[model samples]
Target: MRHRRSIDLMPREDAADDGATLELLPEWYVLVAKCGKCRHQGRIDRRLVANRRGWGVSLNSIGPALKCVRCGNREGNKLLLGRLPRD
Candidate 1:
């Protein structure tokens, strides 16, 4: 049987009012986090996060759940979406 290549889905609910969940995000768009206390920046893999917290969690909600790997900051860490190279 002939089969077609699978395509990754793009974020469906990215809006001005709210953030998109992991289920809506594509694999290329990685999650970047910045520590509010020490200003340390780090890149987090979406697959690792989804495994722990499930894919239903929102991007905005992931901030509070993160602890800074550098300074051990518990609150105010910001999560930003970073795009990876397609090529």
Candidate 2:
């Protein structure tokens, strides 16, 4: 059986009420992605997210579809979301 992980998508839900829709999330905030396989983690720019839309990913489901640069895993739904540290 495959392991199932829970991710906190609450921030995005909260952001949505503040006019920060997923499609425009990158414009307003930076996102952190953690790999489910190798556990690799990194920051993903909002523009890159916007670009992902062009590849057919819907805004609502982008989180779980992200690929891990280190492991190339596609089980994005299990990916956690966190705020990037301010510069």
Point to the candidate with the largest lDDT. Answer: 1
Q: Write the per-residue lDDT of candidate 1 for residues 19-56, one digit (tens) a residue.
A: 56888877777788878899888888888899999999
TM-scores of all candidate predictions against the true structure:
0.75, 0.53
Worst 10 residues of 1 by lDDT: 4-13
Mark the 10 consecutive residues where model 2 has the least summed lDDT.
1-10
lDDT of candidate 2 at residue 59, scale 0 to 100: 43
Could you tally the backbone clashes for each prediction? 0, 3
For 1-87, candidate 2 gives per-residue lDDT tens digits of: 222223333334333233334554443344667677787877777567667565344444666777888878888434334543447
Cα error of candidate 1 at position 82, Å = 0.5
What are the Cα lDDT values of the candidates?
A: 0.72, 0.54
Candidate 2, residue 39: CA error in Å?
1.1
lDDT of 2 at 9: 30
Best by TM-score: 1
Query: Which residue segments of model 2 deviate by more than 4 Å?
Result: 1-20, 23-28, 54-60, 76-87
Instruction: State model 2's lDDT.
Output: 0.54
